[model samples]
Target chain A: MAIKQRKLELGVLVASLALVTSCKREDRPFQTSAPSAEAIQFTRMTDFRAGGPSISGNQPSPAMSADETPEEKEFEENAYMVGEGKRLFSAFNCVGCHAHGGGGMGPALIDDQWIYGHEPAQIFCTIIEGRPNGMPSFGGKIPSFQVWQLASYVRSLGGLVPGDAAPGRDDDMHGGPPENSAPNQKPNDSSLPKSAEMPK
Target chain B: MIAAATARWATLADNDFGVTSGEWVRGTKSVLDPAGPQSGRIHQLFLDYFWLSVVVYVLVVLFVIFAVILRRRRARWTGPILAEPAPSREKLRGWLVGLATLATTIALFFLLAGDHAAGRAIRSLSTDNALKIRVTGHQWWWEFRFEDEAPSKIFTTANEIHIPVGRTIEVELHSPDVIHSFWVPNLHGKRDMIPGHPTRIAFRADKASEYWGQCAEFCGYEHAKMRFRVVAEPEEKFNAWKAAQLQSSVQPATDSQKKGQYVFLHTTCVMCHTIQGTTAGAMMGPDLTHLASRKTIAAGSLPNKRGHLAGWISNPQTIKPGVRMPANSLPPDQLQALLDYLEILK
Candidate 1:
């Protein structure tokens, strides 16, 4: 009886193999468009990381945006959009991973180690499509509008965006300059010793 | 004073630490007393090896006593058989030893055949008439997703799984964080849930009762406390549970409950959990849509009661060490209201 059962299982396994091989390849695109006409939502990505940082600089300046509408063009330098991203940075627990731009479980957002590059669009896509080490994609949980806000804020984290485009402080007690503050200054190279050793 | 202390300890035991002694010795956790066809086959194989070992032990002991120690050491002058110089019987002795060796080989072959039969009985994974469920293991919890051909028909759950009795259920096991094993001793043997690669465990549970399952693999700090329940029921009851799981969470009934709902959504609870129909759609933690219907909370760490729920909400780290959830330091009133809201999730 057991032998017969084993033979049956073997037969079933063979049949499944044939069925799977003959089936068409399923290409499940993870990029979901916005749900409401309010935004271009796709179901695959809408649920990625609702609270995580969004990558597509929600609204880059039309000049920088490949396909920016007038609505999207204003997001580039919009202080309100930048401020909203700052709030999302904390709410989605981005502060938990990339701690105050210094880094903890994730890389330092303020540093030069751009694992995925530093374009506004690149950052936006990086956030949506998470990286290997620790970053989780926040495509769905966070609306696309909020993702744009988050992208603008993340761009300002490394002083990549104009200092005026970043937020300094608020009711939420986030650490940094206001969106209208000074631009990021290059560190002085004069502090380094002329030689690679201490003066004798 | 002593009685009061004893009563306090008893309450502690009930809420934390161990289960009752009766439940341990002859409970659903016992692998010896199986309630499913797969488990029964495994138990039979275990007994087969155990009895075979016993027989081998007895035979070796008898050989040592009668053949080696008690045989003929005192014999040269006392035994006629020893003095006979049995050269003529050498062929006969060699033949006898060869026959005995042949018998042992045949016995071993049958034992191996029995083992193969047991393995096949449990792990066939044939699901033509079977129900399918995906069991994903997280850091210290279990997440269950019922399978359906249609995407909209599928629903996810946490901690508990309800299956129809006397029907094969194919469980696709995977782990997102670390390695873990699923073991419901009363139903089947353990199967490892690896990280990327998924495995299947197919079994037909015959009985209609709650079977306790625990993370048999050491996953992390809370591995020992990571437990779940398999509620095997009649087909109708199982279907009812599934139906309830598919629906969205109910709204709060009273004024305080509504206020509690506001607090829960506003707080950090939404950061890690999903309460369907609300803004709390994060999947970092378990689904809390049908939390109230479950028998226990925190993945079977405590009984689902008002005080335990309140205590757990206040300080999850105290009951189960290294749990991912941090203590929510809400004011007394807000905490009470949140608990009230959570109780109505059914």
Candidate 2:
């Protein structure tokens, strides 16, 4: 009976250890781990040009790929990063022109039409180098990591990122439905002028 | 001890106690200094209540002593056997109780009437020709927007409020995030600024002095740091301040100041703040058009000095944790240039 009792105790201890080890642990609630600047490479994933061919239908453009880098995965899938990016969107006054993605001074970010390519790299370039006319360059202003986060949030607004990673109802006045409910949109080829300049 | 307390109360009613010392003795000055007409009426009622309470306390203490002495005398004269009181003594005791009850009733009735009158008087303060100001409470700050009939005269400021002495100022309160109480104890009482529900209060400062105000309600993390100053100055001075606030930002005259302006426009500051005559015109944060004119920063958490401003820019969370403004890690040269540029904003 003593041997059987000892075995039961050892089994219980092993089960508790397994349970504790199985649960993921983070040092802090929000992931502040900075993404490497060089981790984003979209050349193979997207056939992006200054004025790329436009396609019709609900299908993703032929240039799109299924593979995603680890950095891109964290940016697009991590709930904390996406939530922080949503806050940055308002803090950086993106909502001033974008007006919660419906767009006022800037184009509607949630729509399928892409004046520039809708790939993650394309969006990053747009924010960093800026487009012509109304878009002001923020290359040297905002930190590169924050620009990446903002780009990830913009993708989520278009329902490009997974729904679970998107933000819920905000405390501010409602401009549209919660971002988690954003309808899925397929990225389209660019409609920019052929001679339109592109960021290096 | 009672006399000493009353003397202290008298000093508080004078309004000169903290003015000369330049130190705000929070509760005493805030409650007793009646700088405005509305607060003066309230203060008078409060004094009446204080005197009545003092009188009641003295009378009650004297009655207790008399009863104790009478009991001792009866114990000495009467034998060890305790007998019931005579009919005459019982009648006298009944009369004393009835007199005490009547006195208490009369005193309470007087106070009730005075309170009703004071409330009516506070509400009856004139709104005609009163300057209209809209106050919006944020998570840990206050925004004041002045309205005028002319479009050019309208301007917005934060933290500090400037008013002309002897002129009634009507303030409408709003809160975008949470419930916050607006209170300037010397000038007026507390009013809650609730989200979606706006409130209004009016008062006229008869004295030209600085009165401190703070958010009385318990708000988020930095609620204690949320304070403001109300400066009641001459009309001409107030007009001049308003005119300066309405003008566009001053042009950078020096190279450092110029660099500072460029940095401000290019950096994350422009994303939240607005400065007139500049390309940086977003409204997520306070308007810093006349920042240098204000006496304090961070909703009066720190005095508006060069070192404090630098520290605040370097790390706001150190001074006020959970503040929405993030820390900017700028190099030494940029930080100094920014300070120089901000200093001339007055």
Q: Estimate, for each residue in B112-217, the C-alpha lDDT of model 1 and write its tens digit.
A: 9999998887777467878999999987999999999988879999988889998889899998777999998889999999988999888888988777789999
Name the lDDT of candidate 1. 0.72
- CAPRI-wise, candidate 2 is acceptable
Q: List the residue pairs that clash in candidate 2.
A: none
TM-score of chain B of each: 0.84, 0.90
- Please give the range of 10 consecutive residues that has the lowest summed lDDT in model 2 chain B: B19-28
Lowest lDDT sum, 10 consecutive residues, model 1 chain B, at B18-27
Give per-residue CA lDDT, model 1, range A1-200, as digits (tens). 99999999999999999887534222111222221322232212223434553455333222233242334434446565676577667767898888766688987666445556555555665666576667775543344555666776776776656554456665544455554453454422132333544687
True contacts kept of each: 0.04, 0.43
Q: Mind sharing the TM-score for model 1? A: 0.60
RMSD of each: 19.6, 8.6
lDDT of 2 at A72: 58
